[model samples]
Target: MIVVTTPTGDIGHQLVEKLLESGASVRVIVRDPSRLSDSIRNRVEIVSGSHADANVVNQAFEGADAVFWLVPADSKADSVTAAYVDFSKPAAQALKACGVKRVVSVSALGRTTPLANQAGYVTASLAMDDLIAATGVNFRALTMPSFMDNTLMQAAVIKAQGTFFSPIDGDLKLPSCATRDIAAVATRLLLDESWTGQEEVAVLGPENISFNDMADIMSDVLGRPIRFQQIPLDAYKARFLQFGYSEAMAHGMTDMADAKNRGLDLGVERSADNTTPTSFRQWCETTLRPAILD
Candidate 1:
C-alpha cells in the first residue's frame, strides 16, 4: 500500500484520485480522519495522527511500500524552519527504520540558491529535503516553482479590486506549474517506480511568464480588465501582519518577495525527459477560470 501525507490538500487530493484509479490499496496519514469525506475515509486506510510524533509516523510507515511527503506551510509557529524540520526528522527516521523504499516529496524551487537561507519558505523547504534524503530512502524531491493555483488566493482580490498585488517584479518571467500537473507527475513516478535515489525534480511550465502577462490572462478569464499592482515591501508586510502573521512570518514573506524580484527565486534547473504539458494560459483557461467563474 502507498501512504500519502497531507491527502486533503489540493495536489494531495488529486494524487489520491490517481492512486485510486490505479487500483492501489491506499493508506493515508491525517491529523483528523473524521474531517475527510466519508467517500475518502471509507475507501482508504487512515492512520489518524500528525507526523510530528515518532510513534505516530512509525505506525503510519508500517507496511507502507512508498510514501508521499509534504511539509505544510505553517506560519504560526515561533520558528517555522525548526517546526518543519523537527516534524520531518521523525518521519525520515521512521522511513529508515521501517525500510520504506520510495518517497516523493513536495518542495519549493531554488533550494540550492545562495539566498535561500534568508528566503523563509524556500530555506525551510531546502532543509526539509535534506533531512528526508538522510534516511537513504529512494527519494524524489519534487522541486516546483511558484504554483499557478496561487492565483486562486488572489481570486477575491481580482474580483473586488480588479487587480492582483505582489512585490515580485512585473518584468521577470518567473516559472509556474499547476498543482494538478505536479501531482500527475508525482503519481506517474510513484506508480512506475522507474527512477530512484535522492534527486531533485524541477518542474516548470512550457515557458516562463511574467506577472503582467498573468494579469492579462486573468483579464480574459475573468471577462474584465485586471491590473497588476506592485505593492511596496512595507505595505505588503503590513497587509500580512493584518492577516495575523507574526512579525517574523510577515517579514519572511517580504524577504521572499525581495528575492523573487531580484530573480533569485528562478532556479532554472529542470528535467527534460519527464516534462509534463500545461502552459499558464491553459492552466488559467481550463483549471483556474472554472473555479473563479463558479
Candidate 2:
C-alpha cells in the first residue's frame, strides 16, 4: 500500500490520480473527505485526519509500503510551515516504525539560505529534508521551483489593472515551472524504487523567463495587452495583510518577492536527469487558459 498526505493540494491531487492510474493500493489523508471530487473519493482508501497528529500519521501509514509526505499550511499556524520539522519528524519516525522505507516529498528551492526566516518556507523545508534523511529511509525530496500556477493569484489584479504586479522585478529571470511537471517527477520517483538513501531533485523549467516576458505571454494568450508592475514592498505587504495573513507571513512573502528580484530564489539552471519542463508560454496556452475559462 502507498500513502499520500495532503491529497487535495495541487501536487497531491495530481499525484493521487497518477497513483490510481498505476493500479496501486493507495491510501490518502484528507481533512474533509466530503469536499473531494467523486472520482478521487471513490478511488483511494480514505483516512480522515490532520497530517500533524501522530495517530493520524500512524493510521495513514499502518500497512503502507511507501509514503508521499507533505507538510501543508494549516488554519491556525501563524507560519505557513506546519512546524514542518516537528510535524514531519513524527511522520518519519512512524514511517520507520511501520517498517516502510520508500518516500518522496515536496520541498522548495534554496532550502539552505538563512534569510528565508521561519515563514521562509525554503529553510524550514530543507530542515525537514535533512530530518527525513537522518531517519534512513530511501527518500527523494522534490525541490521544486516557483510554481507557475501561483501566479494566478495575480489574475484578479491583472484583469482589474491590465498588469501583473509583484515585488519581483520585471527583468529578473527567476526559474519557474508548472506544478504538473513537479508532480510528474515526484510520482515517477515514488514508483521507481531503485534509488536509495536520500536524494534531492530540482524541478527547473525548460527555461527561465522574467515577468516582462510573462506579461507578453499573458497578453498573447488572453488576447489583450498586459504589462508588469513592480509593486512597492510595503504595498505588497499591505495587500497580503488585507487577506489576513499574519504579519510574519506577510513579511515572509514580501521578503521573498524582494529576494526573487535579487535572484535569491533562483533554481538550478540545469536538471540532473535532463528533463525539459514546459515553458511558461506553453503552460499558459495549454494548462492555465482552460482553468481561467472554467
What is the lDDT of every predicted structure here? Answer: 0.82, 0.78
Cα shift from native, residue 33, model 2 (Å): 0.7
lDDT of 2 at 264: 54
TM-score of each: 0.94, 0.92
Candidate 2's TM-score reads: 0.92
Error of model 1, residue 81, in angstroms? 1.1
Predicted candidate 1 versus true structure: per-residue lDDT over 55-135, tens digit per residue: 888998998889999876666666657657776988989999999989999987776677777776667778888898888
Q: What is candidate 1's local distance difference test score?
A: 0.82
Top model by TM-score, which number? 1
Q: How many clashes does the backbone of model 1 have?
A: 0
Which pairs clash in model 1?
A: none
lDDT of 2 by residue, 1-294 (tens): 889898889889988899889888889998999977899898889989887778888888888888998887632356635557777877877888887768899887765544445335566677788888888988888887678988787767777677777877788887787888877887888788788878788887777788899989988997888899888989999988898877766776776666656655553556557344688998888866665545
